[model samples]
Target: MPIDIETFDESSSDELNTLTNAEMVVRFLATNDDKAYTPSEIAERIDIKKNSIGTVLSRLEDRNLVRHKGDYWAIGERETVRDAYRTHRIMEALDERYGEEDLEEWREHAAEGE
Candidate 1:
C-alpha cells in the first residue's frame, strides 16, 4: 500500500514528488511487509488514481516484485518463495540419484567438521 497521505507526517510531498508512479507504489508496498492490498486500497493511501492502480500493479507483477492471490495483492520475491522454488528445483533434479538417509548422514558429518 502507498503511504497514507493524510496520516503521513512529512511536512512536504518532496519525497513522493520525485518518485515515478511505479516507484511510489513499490515503496508503499515494501513498507507494509507481507500485507495484501487491493487497487482501491492503494489509491486511497497514495497519489495514484484508482484507475491507475491496476496498471501499476500489472507492471510490478511483470517485474516479479508483486503478485495477486485471488483478489488481493502481496509482495513477491520474498525469501521463502525464492528458497522454496530453488529447493524444489534442486530436489527434483537430484532426488533420484541420492537417498534421503545418505543426505542426512552427509549433512551431519559436514556439521561435525565445522
Candidate 2:
C-alpha cells in the first residue's frame, strides 16, 4: 500500500518545522505522490533554496526514497525503496567483513543455482 498521509502530516507547518530540509522534501513528495514536481517548485513549497535542493534531492535519490521522471521528481515505490535500503545496509555490513567479491560469491551461493 502507498504510505498513509497521516504518517507525516503535510498540512501542519508546525510539524513541518520540526523536520530537516531533506525530511521536509521527502514528506512533501510522499504526500504529493499523485503528481511530480520540479526542484524549484519543491523548494518553494518546502521553504528551501532552489539552488541547494539538488544535494537534498540527490541524497534522497541515492537512498531510493525519490525518483525522477524526465525533469520532474517524485516519490519512489515505497516497498521497493524499503527493500533496496535494507539490501544496501546488508551489503555494506557484509562487504565490511568479507569484501565485495566474497559477498558476490556468497550471494551466488545463496541463490542455489537460480
On lDDT, the candidate that comes out on top is: 2
Clashes in each model (backbone N, CA, C under 3 Å)?
A: 0, 0
Which window of ten consecutive residues has the lowest lDDT sum in model 2? 8-17
RMSD to the true structure for each prediction, in A, is: 14.9, 9.5
Evaluate residue 7 in candidate 2 and report its C-alpha lDDT on the 0 to 100 scale. Answer: 57
> Worst ten-residue run, lDDT, model 1?
6-15
Candidate that would win on TM-score:
2
* Candidate 2 local Cα displacement, residue 112, angstroms: 38
lDDT, candidate 2, 1-114, per-residue tens: 233568545335554345678867877787788999999999998778889899999998888799997779998888866576468558767976887676678888989977
> For model 1, how does the per-residue alpha-carbon lDDT over 1-114 read when each residue is reduced to its tens digit?
435654267524554456667756665666675698887887777657888889989987887777888778876767644564467447745864774457788989999999
